[model samples]
Target: MIISASTVKDTSENVEKFVRRNLLGGIDHLVIFLDAPLPDVEELLDGHPDVTCVRAHGAWWGSTPPGGLNERQITNAALISRLVVGFVWAEWMFMLDGDEVARIDRPVLDALAPQQRAVRLLPLEAASRLHPVADPTLFKRLLSADELQLLHALGVIAEPKQRSYFRGHMSGKPGLRPSADLALGVHHVVDTGTGDRVDTVKDPGLRVLHYESHDGEEFVRKWTALLSSGLDVAQHKKRAPVAASVAALLSLGLPEEQTASLLEELYERTALDDVESLTRLGLLVEVHPDEGPRRPRPPDDEVAQLRELLRRAADVNKRMFKPRARNQRAPALIAKLQRGLR
Candidate 1:
């Protein structure tokens, strides 16, 4: 059976969507750990079939958290990994974030050969919308190293670092076979007892819909929270280049309005501005995420001050994201992308 776990603190709308999508995608069970107590979200999930809600603040962490985002996620996932393997007796466990949904339409582990102990589902990051709304219709996939180099060389991607390929994580999360020899991780698995990283094979039939930053507001919330928090961004080693930039941004300590405006500018610049160009080069994938049950998606729900601030700031200086007109250089760029992938 395929089970999934997440450590989350998000608006109920996002959480509810995550639940409905996973349910429709055929996940056998879902366990959510609320990093902070979210009564609205928890109540929304209460008594739901095949879903277990665990509060992370209470006895889960001895009544005090480790004071960092990564620790909280890793702690909760490790605990759940033990529970699933030792007591729940599940065959496979997937670690997902609240913004991510697994699209498991076909048999995954069930169809895998016995020797494939670990697997990874590539991520399709949600594309940004011109208006401040989630673009559930379009998502972008990561490029192979060759494609990335070509894009950088052709000046299609302004930033030559890893972040240019995809704004969020490209190291996709893991789906693992439970065993005493392995330990669960935030992104991948490790050899238990040895603390060594274990390798994973890419699963061909599975994909994770990663809404890492659903909109301009979400982009502000995520980056602002990180910059404001005293935690070291370097903790995410794979994102060191990103971390360096974040560190530089943090050093500025600009006023909230200035920071928000600058962030939105950056978002507009880096986000999907030319969908047609990427699509023509076979880089973009269009997908209509499963609209979970017909119930309302909790758009009008109340959230804490942080989310409210993001919404207002993002709205105050709103800008439309019209795609740039195709230029003569577009054809050559597409040719470079296609030819390099070979």
Candidate 2:
């Protein structure tokens, strides 16, 4: 089994932690393909002595090949990895993004067969929801390399229409391999950057943590800069808005689901009149901008206003001590004001 990772510095911590935790007794070789600069690559290798590290120009192992204005750095990396798999005599070659981790319940080598094309390991997804809890689910896996060349050939080209078919080709079969009995799951920790504190996966002893969600502004900056140099510029930029929203929501003490709802309320302008009232009463618990003023108090103006309102109600009640004729307006006004106070 070969563990391969291609990444920049932002994800280095997650990759390092994942490798340290999961690369246990049976793994024959641990290979990390660093797509960052040589200096960053050396930095990643500084502490991780158990894993073998290789520096590369780009990520090509599990992604589409570059074309047109896009450079072929990724394509070259893919080709190199394919060759390594074939030549290294690896029975099982597992490829993943640097932020992604593979969690196995049973030993991986025990599942391999002599003539199998490739095994599809699924991921368990961890995400935050509005209910103040985490949601965990199973994710799909990529092909185990039976024929590296075939997989590599398809990877260099964009095949949105052919993705499923490509998986079939990797399976070396007509369509998807029907393996209902042995469903190896992948836990995609895609929304690690989410605000809601939800546990995404069940208590399945098997799950991999994909650290894509944990990335912050620095990660975004580095990735966009690197990918923009010679890769798909738009693809790298697409994550910005979502990432920003996630960061903003986290700043708001609300859970993921509540944040989304609050955002929706903000968009609809439904929070306008009630905003002041809620804030005054301490009913609104919005995250302060810049973490400023953690200990919040009701505004003096609001407190004064409430006091004046109560005083006016008490004065009116005292003035209307006796019930007047049914036709009198003073009693009606007093009743209306009292109702309003309630």
Candidate 3:
């Protein structure tokens, strides 16, 4: 299976660790699309034979509609999907967030039949009491004993549980067939040609372990960063008022108030004691490790070619959409006028 992800500077360490763990888990290739420029991206991948890094320059948040949903996260997934469809050779591709990992019970390809256009993996949220860690291996070790939680059913609507806490808990992410003309959303996929939902298989064993938040401080920092990122003007406008209220509360040193009112309102705090619940139900179990041979590194020239493609894509994006000064003439027109005068 092929793995794809998009990331920024703050999440680089987590992304690296995620890739390493996946490689060890027998994933054949990894393609990382960086939304922001990270100078040490290649070094972080450590020249892994099966990894390719692409630096994206376009405005990733442009396509998302104004809502509470994080445009950056959604657009990042879409960008990775676009790239995978354009370049990846794998039949099965899994797109993941920097803080998410997929636990596969069987070989990823073997788990999903060839006829399936996509597969949905249920999400298992992880809880931590300490600050967010940089090492994935260490984080996994910590979470080995840490409690796991799932969103509680708020009510019953037409026989379906109305759970609105985590956005992705109900509709899981699509493990796509890259060859198909599919348009990826945050937690779903649609056919690009027909504009219809793709045929998907639900795999009970393929689960996503999400490190949603590490602690109260981390949660605040995450929200603050999201508010400041300027990815969605509407989202920013909507959050600015709540953030002002939260800031006032923080200045008064009323952290408990902030956690109860602001944090709880934004994220789900219902502790279902999922680890124990799943254990008692005989549902939560570990996946078997795949002991496959180490993958061979791509040819040096192939890596060079991929780098060249990234460079060209960046240049084209800059030329097409880099902001211009007010009433400024187009660059191409200015260049042509200057050449004529010369």
Candidate 4:
């Protein structure tokens, strides 16, 4: 199996330890791509057998002299290369973050005995706003290089949660888009629970617990540091308000009413869920509008609806104007419509 990650030094140790304990009986090999905390990784894999570690940088391009490539584009390039390599030769491979761990009750090989396809479905377990996840899993299908490139073109990997591309094939309201294609789930713990280590995976039979949020600090430091060096750190740092709202909701446990108010205010200028997500990272901040009263927020139920409407509007606007999608203002418009409906 191939697992790809960049800037995952902190959490990868735990993941590696967990994998060593759990996964067994493999005839071929296991390859892991890790980008930072070189010494720590070496320590974790010191005596492990049948494991190959690549001192990989997330960037598709090679390292940047002593520092290594820092930009997201560069990291994406590296991931694509790994995907290409795995798709060609490997029977089954995984694309995941360092903070992520693939969990199963039995051996991974046993799970694959029934499936005959080139790509087997794996589960993705992400934390839920209401409950602490116990066994998080997802049914993920393996992809070839061409399919990976298609997903990249569709903005799946770059911004995985945005459901704009496949919305037509989706159902359910504004919450987690449910799919019957495959049952694989990802237990995303990064922004869900209090401090990220609260088991949020729902299925106990097959589970993977991601400890990256707390463990991957080393990677966080390195990548952002690189970002600060290469680009305008101050500008990247402007995402504070969005980050703060999520903290207020999940960490502080603000009441639904208060949370709704904060989300409403944020939705006027941005997506409420986006603000909540950013807030979970503790990276949100308020920014003044250039003109007008700015965006307005609707009732709680309408928050996600507004986001979807905004996304659709943005798609429509893009086709009509053919203008670049620079911090697109469609979210603001949806916020306005939602407020009007309310």
Candidate achieving the largest TM-score:
1
Backbone clashes in model 1, listed as residue pairs: none
For residues 170-265, write the lDDT of model 2, one tens digit per residue: 121010111111111121111112211222222233344433322122233434444444544445344444434444655778886776565544
Minimum summed lDDT over a 10-residue window in model 4 is located at: 172-181
2 or 3, greater by lDDT: 3
Q: Give lDDT: candidate 2, residue 112.
A: 39
Error of 1 at 283 (Å): 1.6
Candidate 4 TM-score, C-alpha based: 0.33
> Given candidate 2, what's the lDDT at residue 244?
47
C-alpha TM-score for every candidate: 0.74, 0.39, 0.60, 0.33
Task: Let me know the TM-score candidate 1 reaches against the reference structure.
Answer: 0.74
State the lDDT of candidate 4 residue by residue for 1-342, as single tens digits. 332222334454455644443333111233444455467666665445544454444331234332332333233222222222212223333323443444433243335433322222233222222122432221122234655455556544443332321211111100011111111112121111122221222222433333221212222342344343443333433334434444344456678677556544543333212224333533322221111221122233432332233333322222211111222453344344335333
lDDT, residue 34, model 2? 53
What range of 10 consecutive residues in model 1 has the weakest lDDT sum? 315-324
Give the winner by TM-score: 2 or 4.
2
Residue 230 alpha-carbon offset, candidate 1, angstroms: 6.5
Query: By descending TM-score, how would the candidates be arranged?
Result: 1, 3, 2, 4
- Report the C-alpha lDDT of model 3 over 245-325, residue by residue, as the tens digit: 555545566667655565544432431122333445344334332233445544565444444443434422222211111
Q: CA lDDT of 328 in candidate 1?
A: 35
Q: Which stretches of candidate 1 lie over 4 Å from their true place?
A: 63-67, 86-89, 130-134, 159-162, 228-231, 237-259, 270-273, 291-342
Ranking by lDDT: 1, 3, 2, 4
How many pairs of residues collide in each model? 0, 20, 0, 61
